[model samples]
Target chain A: MNIELRLFARYREATGVDHERICSAAETISELREVLLARGDHWLVLADERLCCARNQTLCSLDSALCDGDEVALFPPMTGG
Target chain B: MATYITNEAIAAGQRLDALAPSHAAGAVVSFTGYVRDHNLGEAVSTLYLEHYPGMTERALAALEIDAYARWPLLAVDIIHRVGELTLGDVIVFVAVASAHRQAAFEAASYLMDQLKTHIPLWKRECHTASTTPVWLIPH
Candidate 1:
């Protein structure tokens, strides 16, 4: 499955890209993270466990499901006011 | 109460007055945030604000709805400006209208706190693009 990934905050800065497309062979977030990591190990290290996942702009649990073409946002814990 | 969140333009004084009407609203409490020239050790020239459009509205509306459920709030307005802003430029303003001062004060505080912690706005602190820090806001 292919998914749209949105990045924000330091993650956006680090990757120097706000959004990207990734192809995933597995169906879960754990699988998606692995695919994302393969592209940028630094993103993997920085992303670690602090990022929140959003599916279709709605906040999702770690165990939340995903589907092809979903708009997923990966972000650091929000630091804005 | 009504809510206002914009990335375009806003009039702070007018927004405050409008939220607090003549008769029903006995008190109005307003909270305003400005782009500061300095942060910690850095001399900031201007700040740029960015946000996730759909998510921002969803979070703000959920907050306002919850505030309405909790207080006897008559009206409330939350206006936030986006793009580039300079020192003393108002970035966010929250006004609450209620029959008494208590709810007005509390709701006003609540709006800012919620916006800070929950909204999906991001800010970039620029001493110049070369020396800037971009951050995401919670509310």
Candidate 2:
């Protein structure tokens, strides 16, 4: 499945890019996160325990199922009011 | 209920006035958050706010819905600013209208507290002396 991955704030700055369209065989949000984490050290920001995930613009848990062409966003905990 | 995410300045008074008039809307409450000059014991010069465009609106709208679900709310409006912001600039505005003051006040407080850590927005504080901007972590 192909997933549209989005990074914001510190995550984006750590990776030096805001988005990526990656092909993955993962079936869940956590699986896809592992795929990215295996890439290299720069992706280490995603390993943060405080990281948040969203599927198709709505906040979801890592156990959430993934689908083809799904939009997945990963970012740190929100600091805005 | 309405949610807006824009870099433009938010007019709190105008937003309050735009709420639909209702005989039951006997009370209105609002909370406006501003960019402060200091954070983490540093003198901050500016604040840089960023958010996921479409996702941000959806998140805020969801908050508005939740506020209504939890309270007897007549209307809700959430306005948040993005991009570069200087000290004293308004960063967020949350308004709630209800049939009574208790509901209006409680709903407004609930919305603000939930918004602090529930949305996609992030804030980076630029210090007066440091070249690097520090990303803020909500407490």
**Candidate 1 local lDDT, A1-81, one digit each (tens):** 888878776677777878888776658776677667777655764455766767887777656678988887777665445
TM-score of 2: 0.95
Q: Which candidate number has the best lDDT?
A: 2
lDDT for B82 (candidate 1): 73
Candidate 2: lDDT of B4? 89
Using Cα atoms with residue i matched to residue i, what is each candidate's TM-score against the true structure? 0.85, 0.95
lDDT of 1 by residue, B84-109 (tens): 78888898888888999998888888
Which runs of model 2 end up more than 4 angstroms from their true locations? none
Chain B: TM-scores of all predictions = 0.87, 0.93
At residue B80, give the lDDT of candidate 2: 92
Where's the lowest-lDDT run of ten residues in candidate 1 chain B?
Answer: B130-139
* TM-score of model number 1, chain B: 0.87
Top DockQ hit: 2
